[model samples]
Target: MQFKNIISGAAVLLASAPAVMALGSATVVNNCGYPIYFASVGQSQHANMQPLQGSYSEGYSQQGVGISIKLAPNNTVGGPVSQFEFTWANGKIAYDLSNIDGYPFSAGGMQVVPSTQGDSSNPTCVPVDCPAGQSVCTAAYNAPDDVRTMVCDENTSLTLTMCPGGSAKRSVEVREHIRYRVHARHFTVEQ
Candidate 1:
């Protein structure tokens, strides 16, 4: 009876050995919320990727201003990886404008209008305050208003007001709007 028990235990150990030694697959996936757009990737070090045995190289993508890498099976290798770096984008507007009277006040928001019919060569003028009696002025700025959620490509009209934060009264052609640029960035990690 003792000999039989010893033989059965050895057989069970032998049967599970192969299962324990079986290696896991390597896969990469984007677990991040942001996506990278227009990206370049390389090993963090000059030595290139020091992947552990049984591990494999996956791939990457540029979503908005974020970069995502995907892996399969997610196992095997010497150990976990370090960190990664990248660059990307944020949805922003850009343009030029000319104003005439009271500072342009559109409690609504600024509109980004594209044109080819109008004089494209006209030099973009600087924003200036209206002289006495002049209720209008002209300037340009990428609409920072939360138009993405409120309005979709709304026309950038104007209200001749005493100040930017003032109340709107009469409409005017000369708009003292703001023109500027925006920069966006993002990062990712792998283990």
Candidate 2:
């Protein structure tokens, strides 16, 4: 009888208490004038993430977790409106911003910036920091501005915005991660 009562009490308590799930936090900032929908490509394994933080942004989870968020301009995901918050595992990621279409006429571009060291996924990433208002695809023969790589090993903030005019992009990190980033000409992703 005592055992039964104890079990029932425990059940009640458990049922009353909310379920706490563990997830990593990652933030994507929008510095662009227009809105952008950002999505995180799932990794077979979540590398090594820790300490879940903030709510899921744009339906992104370590995997099989929460509803994806439809990111909008100025609105933030997995973080405050100003900056993005990332779970540990999701926090550390490698991404690049490049002009896939060598459209010589296109002037818009994106720049990938990271706090620590980062590397490019493209071998032909002839790193060149082209400022905003300038062109990355030069004459279609020459390579556009260098591709930008970012690695947020620690729980840090990553800003995704249009390439600023004549911004200097840097790269200095081992190819430890395999993430992809491609900036299409005046493009938006809806997934």
Best by lDDT: 2
Report the C-alpha lDDT of model 1 over 80-166, residue by residue, as the tens digit: 211212222232111222221112222211222222213333222112222222332223212333212111111211111122333
C-alpha lDDT (0 to 100) for residue 180 of candidate 2: 55
Candidate 1 displacement at residue 86 in angstroms: 20
| lDDT (C-alpha) at residue 135 in model 1 | 31
Which runs in model 1 stand beyond 4 Å of their true positions? 1-20, 25-27, 37-191
Q: Model 1's lDDT to the true fold?
A: 0.26
Clashes of each: 27, 25
Which RMSD does model 1 reach against the true structure?
Answer: 27.9
Question: Each candidate's lDDT (Cα)?
Answer: 0.26, 0.35
